[model samples]
Target chain A: MDYVLELQDVSKTYGHGRTAVKANDRVNLQIQPGEIVLIMGPSGSGKTTLLSMAGLLLSTSSGIICVLGEQIDHASASHRAHMRLKTLGFVFQSYNLMESLTAIENVELVMNMAGVRGSRAKERARELLAMLGLGERLDHKPADLSGGEKQRVAIARALANDPPLILADEPTGNLDSKTGQEVMELLCCGLGRDQGRSIVIVTHDHRLRSIADRVLWLEDGQLSETDGNYLPEMT
Target chain B: MFKLAWRNLLHERARLIISVGGVALAVMLILLMAGIFAGSEEHAVAYIKRQPADLWLMQDGVENLHMSSSLLPPQVVEDVRGIAGVYQAVGLLYSTGAVDLGETEVYSYIFAVEKGAPFGGPWDLMEGAGSPGIDEVILDSDLAARYGLGLGDTVDLLGKQLRIAGLSEGTFGIATSITFVNKQTLAGLMGVPPDAASYVLIRPESDADRVQVADRLKEAIPEANLMTREAFVASDQEMIRQMGADVIRAMNSVAYVVGLLVIALTVYTATVERAREYGVLKAIGADTALLMRVVAAQAFISSGFGFLVGIPLAYGIGALITTLLPEMLIVIEPDNLLGQVPVLLAITAAASLLPLGRIIRLDPMTVFKG
Candidate 1:
């Protein structure tokens, strides 16, 4: 019953009055430890907004967000940053690796921010890169790496601090079908199952459903759990 | 943070070179101007500084040697010597005359001193005799080399042939070349009384209080102005600085502005190009201070490299100018180079402000979107 992340009646709106746009409307969700949760929706369905709120990257108009059993909906920016450093990790669709840094450096950047440095941080970063199958490319910058390799480096970076939860927004969105499947397998089987860490992935790629312990459908800013048999029609 | 900043700078090699080169050029310009200014001041007062006098007594209302005409009564020298603290007093005769080189005339300031006097004559002798005798002259080596004159060569000064007795080093000013002759000979040529002189040089006793001696001299001789060695040097340098203060100030301002723009534009562009990366960093929990540190590190590295490159380049340029124009004095002092460090650092820090603002206001949500 211990959840890694929880959201209660979260709603986020932009602007005000008649011109206000609701990005997320009254969304509630929770992910237990060691669970793999998948959120699938059409374009403009507020899937990204919901993920942003859960990651403590954006303030919610009205809601309660808890990460690692600490209420953080009203946390200060600095406090939220600290919690993110201590408990949460992020994987972006674009990989978002610092182009100036090598693979090992990108992975070590987070650890450095968390006060880990020198030989220990370097050793851990190398190990993570090698584990992610990027050992030979450790010194190569992002420009020299392929899309799949970049995403792998991003995943290694997200896991650098060993946070309890990983919030991935379309981790495989930029890769080919085969590479996407491979990355998905790595995230689910390699990370979620083998490492016993909770993962929340927001993606439009329904092919990823087989790896999910629970599938949720988001439509017009609302989320609902469903059995694996249901498939939303592709627009 | 420093590693990140260094990597970011090295990531774009072309930008790094251009930015560093720009700063280097600015530094070179500022240093060159300062060196030339300092050189000019030094040259203007070289003769005054070389004198062994601790005090200079001139006619009242005469401010400096170069711009003023001081004709003191020759009796002032004996009067100053009679003082209790007076160690030695020598009279000098200063005038301007032209040396006819057959094809062209070289204008020079003529300094006439008593033969074998303690001061007011050339100290650095490259060749021949140390002090000029009657009808003999000492010319600056730079002037001698330029006109192909040597020791024992005779030159026409004020229509009188005077043999060159010695060649002194580094005694040439931009507008005036100093030539020394016997005081009695110069007085006869100018038709002034041999007992009258331009100024009197005085050396105080070793144990004497210079201020008290100066006060006593002021009281004993109310018609003349008396100044200590340090006071006279400062007055001469201050006069020279004021002459070019407007131009030097304008050039320094331009150099600083150019340096600021170069650094600001390069850093701002680099930051803008990496804005998304910065957002990603913010999203991953980099605080504002850390990000600022990264920027400050970049500025410092750039400035440090620029300074390292600029100093030698300035000196090289100064050497080149001296070779090309022997009359131009470009003296590089250690203090001049050291004085520019703070200004360069300030410009670099100010330049980083442009990029700092861009990074601080960056929204972390942008990384999630695009």
Candidate 2:
């Protein structure tokens, strides 16, 4: 398999000297196209740290991180940021939509920064919003939308650049089970399911286990895959 | 984009309206106060500009005719005319007297000039016959209408019966309405006797520099004060500079400080409301330069609205002042206007900087933490 995201012996240390603590200890992982890898770990098991390093939000202390064939661990801040914006899309636990903008404007905000402009950019945003079931709520402000509607708007914003890799950090952590399921289904139902796009989800929710094709267990700064048919040992 | 900036401004129309209104009101008041100060200076120096004298010889230590007393020998005019480059000199007697026309008692200034000099009297006759003949006088239109007096009308001036010879406009000075008469008539009216005049006004034969002439004349008569026409006008303005300047500065300071405060508050509130929005923008790949541009665009929008409202409002205030205070024309000098717009722009630009610094440093990750 041609892996889209690969990490080799990655190590991350939180502090210096006596207070030093290792988050991700020489961990190795690979995610290929059309793969949904769910990262499961107990509290303080370095799952978020690993995801952060993978998403280019945090730097690893040692080892190589390659995303879209670019070595990000040794890259410049702007270079890594560029990679994050072009090749990666983020859906955070909190649906961070700009309250001042309408639903379509929040999505268009991403496209605007991506240097997409004029009528074509606007039409693309409209189509994206319509695809996310937000066509009628384009003019409605965030305060006027429900929890699920806001999350859908955030999802639309994340997909604005048509990036090939999606990194979701507890995307449904704040939602009810039904709404979480709905958002996850919306994310997985289309191109994410059939097309060759990679998805890495950081979650501890057992309910989301059935949707992911593979589940990676992270504990004591190590990772191993578990079968989807059996319950994995916690921590 | 500029369209986004414009829409953001319009979206908060009420708040933006209040902000622009504050700036416009400040601009109007600043222009009006400056006009009043200019008007006062012009009123104080009106006669000095009109006088055709190359030099004025008055009593030693006298600064201006309005603010100082000048005593000189009446024979000084003849002595100054004998100096080289001196063509003709006139002995002028400046004094104040009341003219009583039965129902109205009008205070009038009397300027006594030698009979043959060019600076003999006022100009632009309106309704009367001509220059004051022997024992006659000139009355301005306002004074004439108020006193119901016209040509050949007998007026009691300083206990002597005088006749109205002509009507004119702008014949009033800082003291009161001016009446032109010969030296003999004025000397008799003021009871100064024959030996003394107020000052000697001299005209150079050629267009010689008045400062050189004044110096030479001062050397000839050490007991007298020498002044050029420009110096005389400047001295006259000192009284207005003393009177209206403090008031103008105070008014401008109040308007400027209040305008700055309003701009600061407006920008601060707007930035506070958009803090989360700024974070979202950063997360979406907008850089610091792009964020600053959006903020500057918003300021431009606010200032443009203020300019649209302020410039016209300043003119209207000037017109209203001129109409209500007819004797005064609110003069907005070029320097005063040039200084004000930039001050407003500076306040606006500075106001934006404070909030921009706050917005630029905000991290997008913090928004996710929320």
Candidate 3:
């Protein structure tokens, strides 16, 4: 399968000498269209580190990252952010919804910042919220919504630009088991339902493992594929 | 994108409210001080405007009537009248005295124009009267309100008892209300033995050159000082300007400092509070200039709200002050108030720049770390 996002020999090191920790060492990954890939690891197993590098949120100490066959490792800061905003959608662990904005407004915020103005952008935001089953919560602010609703709103925001690649770091980490499962299912099917896009969710929740098409286990900065059902059942 | 800036301002409603209040307070202080300065200016020129003559003839070498002139002989009025284009001339004594209203004594200025001279008085009347005769006096509205005097009341002026005739409005000097009386009444009140008046006022023909009339009067009576109407008004205005300009300037500077500090702290707090949101915005392709504009837009929102509330509050407060104060204590000129809008905007923009710097430094990767 042709990879929609590819990372080659990616490495990120923090500090130096004895105190230095290698967050990711020569990490390599590939994500293809219409696929949902899950990266599961403990807190320090470099799952988020690798995800950040793939998402272009952080600069790698060394190596190349290619998105849609375009090398972004050497891209300018503004160019990289533009690529992220236009071609990549991110779902943060905390949901990262602007608490002040209503659900629909949060979605519209991304569209508006991307130069979408007036009533059309607003209508598009409403459509996305309805697609996420948040039609009734459109005008509800983040503070007034439930955990599941907020996560769905975050998913709607990530889908704002209809980007080809979605990068999520523990997207359901803050939800309870039921909401987490619903969020995982929503996220897994959120973009992959479209033929031209893919999702890469970095999470430790075993429940999410069943929803992802393939699971990649990261232990001590190394990735290896595991049977999707081998993880211990979530409580 | 800039529309997002406006939405963000509304989103962060608390910050908007607080910042608007700060700007309004600063605006109020600045406007009030401006009103006082304007009032002082009007007061300084009041008597000059009512001088009854187009030409002022004082002792030679006089630069200001209030400070520099010696008493010119009453005969100087005849000499000035003899000058070509001089229409009418009247000699008058201008001095300061104390008036006794029962247990309270008030200091007042005495302007003694000849009875039935071309010069008249204020815009309105508030107390006992107009065109006072010998042993008669007029009290300013504020003075009447202050001492509880009425039209039929008798007051002691510089020791002589004079019956109150009519009250005038909008003609109060800095600390005193002026009394207008005929030359004989004022001279008698001052114990000048009703002799030659202190200075002469000359009215030139309507189309005549006032400066030329002034020069001819100077030549005709070398012992008297001659000044055009404009010079006379300017000289009087300069005294108040000199007395109060520095203080007003310093107050204005303090107001600006307070405004700057308030806006800076408020915007800076807003920026720091939303550091993560800024990260999200940057991650979403918001450029540096876009972020700067967003910050500036927030400042504009705050200032715009301030403009709406501050101007009317300024007028309301100014009105209250105008009511409580003598007319000369506050002048709320619309033009002066309107002129301050741009200056306030400049302060708000400049103060918000520092917070914009903080916002521009936000990195999209910062939020991912959390």
Candidate 4:
């Protein structure tokens, strides 16, 4: 199978000697194109660390991380940034949008960073926001939007660059249950099934398991696949 | 990037106004100080510059017309006129005297000009005759309006009654009000011999080289100090600058420091406030240079608006000074205003440094957290 992301025995350690903390230990994972993978774990169980390593945001102490067929473990910072821009998208829990910019502008900012400019960038931004059911709220700033609308804007921003792999870290954590389900439905059904983009979500919500093609459980710096019966209260 | 910078500034309107207002006030202060200095220098040399003489001859020890007194033998004027390049030579007598205006005694500098000569007389005759007869005086219009004196009005100078024969424009220096009279009258009033004068004014022939004529005249009258009109004007301005350059420099230093601090604090606070947004940008693939451009754009925009507000404010202040202090001259030239452009740009550039460091070191990982 064609893999969008593959982590081969990746381990990350913080600090030195006796004080060293192992965040990720020999983690091996793979997500195929058009697949949705959910990673669940208790707090401080290296769920975010695994996502960070897979996204090329954090370096691994040992082993290799490949995204979109490129081994990024030994890449320079600038080269990693280029790979991130060209091959990956990110959705955070807080809906990180520039407060000064409107919804469409926030979406367009990512495109701008990718060297797209003028009316073409604006058109793409409008198309993305409208596709996410935010057509009427295009001109509204983040402060003026509800939690659901803000998450939608963040999703629109992540999809601005059209990267193959979407790394979402608790994207629906801050929303109400209804809004969180709606956001997950938009991601799994709209982006995965329709656009054929691979998704890796590090979430604590048990309800999200129904939409995942496979569920991965993380415990004490180790990752393992499990059936939905092993769910825990990770809050 | 530019739009982001502009929107970020506008997001905090109150802070934006304060930052721009601070820079505007600084610019206004610096311009005002420079304008006042230039005006004073121009005023000090007004009378000398208006004269038609190419060369001025004084006693060998005298360098300026304000504080020093020079007495030349009357034969020197005739001897200078005998030179090949000399067109006309006239003797002038300068003395300080007080004019009694009934309730006030106004100090005046008496300029005694030879009758019918072009060298040492008022050229801008606003009203009445250019040449004042014996026991007559030509007053600057500014001086006349101040004292309510007009043509045909008589005033007491040196205990002698003299009639106001003419009024000239722009003859009032910063510290001196000049009054022109016949040479014989002033010589008689001071009890000096009619054959003696304070300085000799010489006009070179239209076809003659002024430097060569001045050199030849310098050789002829070795006992006198000879200078061209430009040299004398420069010397007078230099003397006046020496009196106030220190004060102007101090004021300029204060203004620049204040400007720098205002810009630094505002831009730094703004950058720190937006640190999270900058981190998100970095996480999303923005380079440090791109981030710095945004901060620099903020500084430049603030300075541009400040300059827009400052230039008009400086002109308004100059107008107010002119209205409140009629005797004071505040000249705002275009060059003086344009000269501040580079200074403002430098200040804005320097101000961006404090914020640029914060942006460069900001951790992009912070954007992942709530």
TM-score of chain A of 4: 0.97
* Error of model 2, residue B96, in angstroms: 10
**Residue A119, model 1, lDDT:** 94
> Per-model C-alpha lDDT, please?
0.87, 0.76, 0.77, 0.86
- After TM-score superposition, the amount by which residue B349's alpha carbon in candidate 2 deviates from its true location, in angstroms, is 3.1
Q: Comparing to the true complex, what docking class would candidate 3 get?
A: acceptable
The lowest-lDDT stretch of 10 consecutive residues in candidate 4 chain B is: B169-178
Error of 4 at A155 (Å): 1.4
Put the candidates in DockQ order, highest first. 1, 4, 3, 2
lDDT of 1 by residue, B1-370 (tens): 8999999999988988988898899899998888888887888788788888989999999878877788988787889889889998889998888876556677887899777778788868788877789899988888887888888888989999999989888777666677888788899888887777788989889999988999999999999999888889999899888988998889988988988898888888888888888889999988777887888788788878888888899999999998887777998889978888999989999988878778879888987774
- lDDT at position B280, candidate 4: 84
Candidate 4: pairs in clash = none
Between candidates 2 and 3, name the one with more favorable DockQ: 3
Q: lDDT tens string, model 3, B1-370?
A: 4555676777778878888888887888888888878776776567777666777777677766565435766566666778898888877788777878888876776777667765544446665445778788877867776778888788988888888887887767556667776678877656664546676767888988977877777677776667777888888778868888899889988987887777778777877888888887787666777777777787777877877787788778878877676554766677877787888888888977887667766777775665
DockQ of each: 0.68, 0.25, 0.46, 0.56
Model 3 lDDT per residue over A85-201, tens place: 788888887778887678998998888777776798789889888988898999998889988898889888888888888888878778899988877676676545454568998
Give the per-residue lDDT of model 4 (tens digit) for B1-370: 9888998999889989988998999889888889888877787677788888888999898888876778888788888889889998888888888878676776777888878877688868899988889899988787778878889998888898999999988767555667888788999998887767788888889999987898899889999999888888888788878878899889888988888888889999999999999988877777788889999998889888988898899999988987776556778789978888998889899999988779878887886787
Candidate 1 structure quality by residue, lDDT tens digits, A84-195: 8878889999999999999999999999999999999999999988888898999999999999999999999999999889999998889999999988798678866678
Clashing pairs in 1: none
